[model samples]
Target: MTEPQTTHFDTVLVANRGEIACRIIRTLRERGIRSIAVYSDADRNARHVSLADAAVRLGGPAPADSYLNVRSVLDAAAKSGSQAIHPGYGFLSENQSFAQACADAGIVFIGPSVHALNMMGDKIRSKNHVAGYGVPTIPGINEPGLSNEQLIEAAGGVGYPMLIKPSAGGGGKGMHIVEREEDLAATLETARRVAQRAFGDDTLLIERLINTPRHIEVQVLADNHGAVIHLGERECSLQRRHQKVIEEAPSPLLDDATRARIGEAACAAARSVGYSGAGTVEFLVSDAAPGEFFFMEMNTRLQVEHPVTEMVTGIDLVDWQVRIAAGEALTVEQSGVHLTGHAVEARVYAENPERGFLPTTGTVLRLHEPSGAGIRVDSSLADGLEIASHYDPMLAKVIAWAPTRLEALTRLDRALGETVVLGVHTNTEYLRLLLQDEDVRAGHLDTGLIERRLPTLAFRGADDHLLAAAALFLHERALNASTTAEANAVWARPTGWRLGEARASRYCLGVSATDSVSVGVRGEPGGASVTVGDGSPVAAGLSAGHDGTMSVDYRGITRVYEVALHGAVLHIGADGFQMELRNRSRAEELAEHLLSRDRVPGAVSPDVRSPMPGTVIAVNAASGDAVEAGQTILVVEAMKMEHKLVAEAAGRVTVNVKTGDLVKLDQIVATITPVNTPDKGATE
Candidate 1:
C-alpha cells in the first residue's frame, strides 16, 4: 500500500447523529481537531450539536432527506470548513459512492478506499473475493446467472437447513433460514423484499446453515503499506432479529487453533480487498462436534461492537481510522498485537423488550447512571432531553471490562440495576435478565440464542402497587419537605403532639401498560402501606424511602419508584414507566378501598367511572343531547395517542365537560341523555 498524496484536515464533520456522532466527536476534540456536526430538523437539539465546534442543518426528519443524502452531508462539511468526514456506523457509512464523493472532492473519508468499498459492498463479491484468498465460505456459489431451478436443485445438493440470503445485503435484511421444502418459496419472497429495501437487489444466494453456530468476528486494521493485522475475534452470538445483542471479546467457544485460523482468514479477507483503515471480518462458527467456521462478511466501517475490541486490544479504532486517512502506516505488527481480559457491552436501547423491541420515545426526566471501576458508559444524553422518534432507539452503550467474563457479566448486571432513567422507557432490565440467564452465562452463545430463549426474559419488571405506594410516600415527603427554617417548626410537624392521634390514609392502586393510578394514598414517616385491586385479589403493599425515591412491594411484584413533583404535574418513574398523576377521583376510591379491603370498612363507590385521567378534547353531547349506545361522545388524548370516549347506554347527556378542561379519572365526561331512553338490556 502507498501513502496518499494529501491528508491534512483541521476540522472533521460527523456525518451522523446520536451516540456514534458524540463518540467520534470526542476523539476529534482530543486531537485538537475542530468538529463539525450535521443534524436533521428532528435533531436540532441533539447531543452532537452541543459538542461540536460548528454545526449545519441537514433538513427534514427522514434519513433520505437528512442523514443518507450525500450532497447534504458534503455541503455541511464544506460549509463548516471540514476537510474530513466521519460517517460513523450507519446510514451512508458503507455506501461506496459516498466514500468516492469525499475522495473525488479531495476530502478525507475515514474508511477504506473507493475500490475496496465497491468490492466489499456487494456480499457475493466480498464473499467470492475472500473465498479466492483461501478463506472458507458457507457452502454455496457466488457466481452469477444461476436460475431458480438451479437454486432449488442446489438446495437439495447442499442438504436441508440452508439459508437464502440476498447476495448484496447485510444486517439481517434479505436473509431467511429455511429447513423444509415447503418453506423455500415464502422465505425467498421475504428475502427478496428485504434485499430490495436494503441493498436494492432481490437476487439471492443459498448457503448451508450452521446449526446453533456462534457469531465470531475479527477486528482488522490495515494501512496502504500492504500491512494488515488482526486484533482477535469477538463473540456476538446473542442476537435478535439477526442484529447483535450482547457482544464480547475472546469468544468462549474459541480455542487456540480456531482463533489462529479465524484470525488469519479475517486478515486475508481484508487483504483481498486491499482494505485500509478499521474494518471487521465476520464469521459463523458451529458448535457441532467438528466445530467449523465460515466467512460471513466484512463491515466496511466501524462497528458498534468496537468497544469490546478496544477493551481487549487497548487501541482506539477511531484514531486509527483518522491516522490511516492521514497517510500514517499502522505501527503494530502481527506479533505485537495482544488481546487481554474480557469485555462485555450491552446496547441499552429506548425500546421495550416485552413489546418486541418497539421503539420508545420520551423525555429524560431524571438520569442517574452507574459509576464505578471497570465500567464505561458511552452516552450523549441529559436529563430533560427528549428522546426523538425520528432516529434509532439505541440510547447508549453500557460496557464493562474485567479479568473474567463472569465478572464482566456481574458488573454489567449491577450497572444496569443501579442505572435510573426517567420519562423514556428503556431496556435496562432486559439486559440484566439476559446476563443472568443460565444459557448466556454458560457461554453457549449464538446469533439465535436470545430469540430462542426470550420467553423467560420477557417479564415486565415494574409493579404498580409498589410504584403507587412509593409515589404516595414521595408525595407526603414532598409536601413535608416543602418547608423553610422560618416556617418549618409550625407548618411541617403536623403530628408532633403527644396527646394527638398519628394516622395515615390508604390507597387502592391499579397498574396498566399505559397508566398507573391510586384511588387513595396512606402515608407515614417510616413507610407507606397500600393495596392493589387486580380484579381478583386486593394485595397489601408497603413502600419506604428517605428521599423522594420509594419502593413498594405487593405480592411477588416489587416496583421501584422515583417521584419528582415539578410545578403543576407530579413526575413519577417506576418499572421503567412514567405516569403523570392529575386530579382523579378514582385515586381516592382505590385508596379508600385499599385501606378498607378485608380489614377496614369498604367505601368503594358504586358509581360508573372513567378508566384514566385525560383532557376532554370534545364534548359532543350537551346536557340534553341524546346518544345511541356505544356512540362516540367525547375524545381524550393520553401519552400522545388519542382515545375516544363512547357512550355505554343510550340516553340523554346529563353533563358534558368542556373541551380544554382536565377531566379526572372516573369523572363524568358525559352521561347518557336520559335513563328512560336507555338502550335495551343496557343499564346506567
Candidate 2:
C-alpha cells in the first residue's frame, strides 16, 4: 500500500441533530476544531445548536425537508466553509449518495469510501459479500427485488420464525418477525411500506431467526493505510421490540478464544470492502451455542452504543473518525487495544414504558442529571427544552464504568435513580428494575429476555407519598404568592383556618382523565396535616431549600424533590420516578364525577382517543361507519413509529380525524356510539 496524503481541517460540520450531534461537537471542541451544527425547525433551540461554534438552518421539521435533504446539507457545508462533514449516526450517515455528493463537492466525508458504503449499506448485498469472503453468515434468502410472492414462497426453505429486514437501513426500523405462514403475507406488505417510507427503498431480505440469541457486535477501525483492528465486542442482547435498551462492553458470554475468533472475522469482513474509519460488524450468537456465531450486518457509521466501547477501551471514536478522514494513519495496533473496566449504558427516551413504550412529548420543566464517580451522561436535555415527536424519542444516555460487571450494573442503576427529567414520561425506573432482575444480574441474557421479563416486572405508580408531596408543594407556592395585605387578613388567608377546627382544604388532583386522587390539607403549608384519599391523616410540612429543591416531610420521612409547576400541573421527580399531577377545579371535579356516574352498566366508552401526539397517517374507518370491536380505526405516526387506534366496542363510528391531521395526546379522534343508542340529532 502507498502512503496516503495528509490534510488538516480547521472547521468541520456535523450533519445531524440531538444527542449524537452534541456528542460529536464535544469531540471536535476537545481537538481544537471549530464545529458547525445543522438543525431542523423543530430543533432550532436544541442543545447541539448552542454547543457548536456556528450553526445553519437546514429546512422544516420533517426529515425529508431538513436533515435528510442532501442538497441542503451540502449547501450548508459549502456556505459554512466546512472542510469536512461528519454525518452523525442517524440522518445521512449510511447514505451512499450523500457520501458521493461530499466527494463531488470537494468536502471530505468522515467515513468509509462510497464503495464500502454501497457494499455494506445494503444488508442483502452485504450478507452475500461477507459470505463470499468466507465469513460465517446466517442462513437466509437475500436476493434484491424479490417479489412478495417469491419471498413468501421462499420462506418455507428458510424455515419458521424468520426475520424480514429492510436492506437500506440499520436500527430496528422496518424489521418484522413471522412466527407462522399465515402471518407472512400481511407482515410482508406492512414491512415493505415501512421500509419504503423510512429508507426510501423497499428492498428486503429474509433471515432465519435465531432463538434465544445474543447480539454481539465488534467495533473495527481501519485507516487509509492498510491497518485494521477490532476493539472487542459489546453485549446488546437486552432489547425491546428489536431495539437495544441496554449495552455493555466485553461481553460476559464470550471466552477469550471465542472473542478472538469473532474479532478476526469482523476485521476480515471490513477488509473485504476495503473499509475505513470507525464501523461495527454485528453478529448473532445463540445462547444455546455460544461458541458459534453468524454475521448479521455492518453499521458503516458510529453507533448509539459506541460510548460503552469508549468507556471500556479509552478511545474516542468520533475523534478518530475525523483524524482518519484527514488522512491520518492508525496509531494504535491490534496488540495495543485492551479492554479495561466494565462499562454499562442505558438509554433514556422520552417515552412511557407502562404505555407500551409509546413516545411522549413535553417540555423539560426541570432537569437533573447524575454526576459522580464512574458516571457519564451524553445528553441533549436542558431546562424548558421542548421534546417534540418530529425526531427520535431518545433524550439522553447514562453510562457507568466500574472495575467489575456487577459494580458497573450497580453504578448504572444508581445513576438512573439519580436522573430526573420532569414533565416528560421516561423509562428510567424501568431500566433500574431491569438491572435488578436475577437473570440480568447473573448474565443469563438473550435477545428475548427483556420481552419475557417485561410482564413479570412490576412498575410503580404514584403512591400516597408522591401525591402528598405534590399537594403540599402547590399549597406552599400559593401561600408564598399571596399579597402582603392578604397575608395579614384572616378572611383572605388560604390556610383553611376556622373559629373551632381548621377546615381542611380539599384538593382533587388528576393523575389522568380517568384516575384521580383526593387530598385534604389543614393549617399552613409549613406545618400541615395531610390525608390522601380515605387514609389516616399524617403530619406533613413543606419547606423551600436554597438549591432549588423542595423538602417534603410526610409521616416522619423527609425527602428532597425536584419540583416544577407549569400552569395548574405539578411535576415532582425523585429517585428516577416522575409524576405529573394536575390540580382540578371544583367544577371540573364535579363534571368528571357526573360523567363517571352517568355511565350505564355493561356499556363501553364510545371515545377513541389518540394515545399520543402525532400525525394521522391513515384512516381506516369513515365517519358514520359501523365498526366492530378491536378494529383499527386509524394509524398515527410519531417519531417513525406507527400506532393504530382501535375501536373498543362494536358501534357506529364517527371519525373526526383524517389523514395528515395532527392530533394531540388523549385527543378524541373518533367516537363509537353503541348500535342501540339513539342518535340525538339536535343535541349531538
Candidate 3:
C-alpha cells in the first residue's frame, strides 16, 4: 500500500491528562495543529479537557477504564478526527503495545519506533545492547537466577555496595542502594517486591554502586535517514529518595572532554538501536576516579527534565519529536547545536516533606506561581482543583535559566520565595530553604543530596516572617474597611496623639508565611491614649480618619491595614481573615487537625469518597452483598496507578460499581448499610 501513504499527518490526539495534557495542547496550538484531548469521566471538567480543540470522553475516572486502556485511547483518536497521537510523558507513553497499536491504526505515534522502545524500555535488554555499541556500562548481569551461593560469591567478587533496580522502570519505582554487604539480601528482596507489584516483574540485576555519583544525561536525536546529534548534558544531582528534585543544564561536574565523551557514547547507543525521534542517554558520573561516567540507561521518551535542555540548547525537543516521527531528517549537526546559558529546575510537589514524602490530597484554594526574569512554571493544576491521593503529588516543575550557575540558583531561590499556595500544604518553604543551604549553592551535590540534608531542608513550620505577614495583611485590610482607622495602625497607633479622650486601642490581625494583614478598632476615635495588650486597650488621641484606610509602621516596614471587628469574621478588602477573640471554633479545628496527624496514606473514610480524579478497577463486593468489618471494598486507578478503597466496618454493599466503571471523588460509588442492621452471621 505504498508504505502506508508516507507522511502528511497533523491534528494530534493527547492521550493523557493533568498538567502535561494542558502543556501539550498549548504547544499544539502554537504549531497550528488541532489538539484532541482524551479524558475519563473524572476529568470531564478538568483544565486539560477545556484546553483542547476537541475532547473525547473515555469512560470512568480510573486509569484502566480510560488512559491505560489501549483500546479506549486509540478509539478516542479515531473518533476525534486526530491523525496522530502524542502520549505525553506518562500513562501509555512508554507502553510499547500502545505505540504499536497507533502505528497499526495508521496514526503516527509522536515518539521513537516500537523497536527502540522495546530495546530501551526493557532496561536489561538496553543495557546489554548498549555495551556492544562501545558505551561504557557498569558491570552488571541481566538474568534473574544465580544460585544463592553464586549470588553471594558474585557480590563478593564484584565488590560490595550495589544498586538493585527494575529493568522496565523510571521515576525510581523499584530502585535500591545497598552499601554494606550485610544489607544486600534484604534490600534486594524489598526492591524486587515493589517492582513485582508495580510492574508485574520481580526480576532484578546487580550493578556496582559508585561512591559519589553525579547524574548526567545527554539528549540525542536521530532520524531514519541516519543522522544523529547530541544536545549538551543536564546535571540532575539534587534528589530526594532517588528521585530528581532539582535539575540543571550544562552540568557543573562535566568538563568539555567529559561532555564530548558522554555525548559521543550516547550517539553511538542511538545508532546501535536504530533509534528514531528524541531520546535521552543517562549516565552516572563517578567522583571516585578521574572523570569517569558510566551508562545508566536510555530513556525511550521525552524526559520531565527536558526543559533544562531546552533553556540551555535553545532547541524545541517536542518539535523535533514530531518532525522526526514524520520521517524528516535531522538538519542540525553537532556544531549547529550550541549550549548557551545555565538553567535549573525544581520539582514542586504536594506532600509533607517531614512525613516520609507521602502524597497529600486537598483542594487548592489559592495559587500564586513564581514569575520573574527567567523563571517558568510548567504545571497542570488550577485554583480550586482537588489534588487527589490517586496520582503523583507533584504539582509543577519550576525552571529558571540564567547566565551562570550562581545566577540561576539565585533566580530559582527568588522564584520559590515569591510562590504562594494556600489551602493545600506544599513544600514551597522546604524548597526555599534548600536553595539557601551552603552545600547546594556550592554545587557539592549527589543523588543522596536532599536525603542527607533534609534535617535542614525539609523544615516544617510557619516562622516569624509568615506570622508578621499574616498580621500585617489583616491590619491593612481592616483599615480599608473602616472609615475611622489610618493605614499605619497595625498594633494600634502608639497610645493617644490625636484629638479625643481615652479610646480602645485594640487591633485584630491575620498572619501567615506568605501573607499578612491587620486592622484597627476605632469605636471611640481621635480621643485619649488607647491601651494595647491582649484585648481592647485605651488610646486617647488616636483620630478616626474619615476615609476607610489605616497605615502602620511596624518592624521598619510601613503597611496599610483595614480595621473592622464584627463579632468574628474580619473582612479585609474582600480577603476575610476570621479573627475570633473567643476560642469557640478555631480551637476545635486545631484540635481536630492535631488528632488527624497520625493517619496513614489512603486511609480516608469509606463514605468520604476521593476528592480528586481517578478510576475504579477492583470491586470486592457486589450490590446487596455483605462485607466484613474493615474489608477491602474496591480498588481505584488514577494516573496509571491503583489505590484500594476499604470498608470502615462490616456492611452490606447496596449500590456497588463495576471494575470498568468510572467514579468521581464524592460521587457515591456504592452505598453501605451497617451489617448489624439486617443480616445475621454470613460466612464467606
Q: Encode model 3's per-residue lDDT on 1-684: one tens digit a residue.
A: 223223755689998887778777887888888999988776777779888998998888667898888998888898887888989887888888899999899888988888888888877788888988899888876655553345656777567677878877887677887779888777777777777778876667778878878888999998778899999898888877678888899888778987888899999999998888888898988755527888888888888888999888888888777777777778899999999889999887776455445445556555667787888888877866776655566788888999999999989888876565544456666777777789878877788777778765545332322223333433334445555556356444433235665333234332221122223334323232222323343232322332233443333444443333334433222111111121124454455456457545565443525333356667777877887767777877654446666667667776557777767534567666665454467555
Full ranking by TM-score: 2, 1, 3
Better-scoring candidate (TM-score), 2 or 3: 2
Go through the candidates in order and give each one's C-alpha lDDT.
0.74, 0.92, 0.69
Task: Report the lDDT tens digits of candidate 2 across residue range 1-684.
Answer: 668899999999999998999999999999999999998999999999999999999999999999999999999999999999999888889988999999999999999999999999899999999999889999988999999999998889999899999988688777899999999999999999989987789998999999889999999999988899999999999999889999999899999999999999999999999999999999999999999999999999999999999999999999999999999999999999999989999999988888889999999988889999999999999998999999899999999999999999999999999998988889998999999999998999999999899898888777887888888877776666777985758766668876888778788999985668899988787889999999999999888822258888998898888888888888777888777788998888998899889998677778999888899999999998999999999999998789999999998999998899999888999999888766677575
TM-score of 3: 0.75
TM-score of model 1 (CA atoms): 0.78
The residue-by-residue lDDT of candidate 1 on 147-218, one tens digit each, is 666677667778788878887777665567888998877777777776776677777888888888788889
Question: For every candidate structure, what is the RMSD over all alpha carbons to the true structure, in angstroms?
Answer: 8.5, 3.0, 9.4
lDDT ranking from best candidate downward: 2, 1, 3
Residue 244's lDDT in candidate 3: 85
Positional deviation of residue 362's Cα in model 3 after best superposition, in angstroms: 2.0
Backbone clash total for model 2 is 0
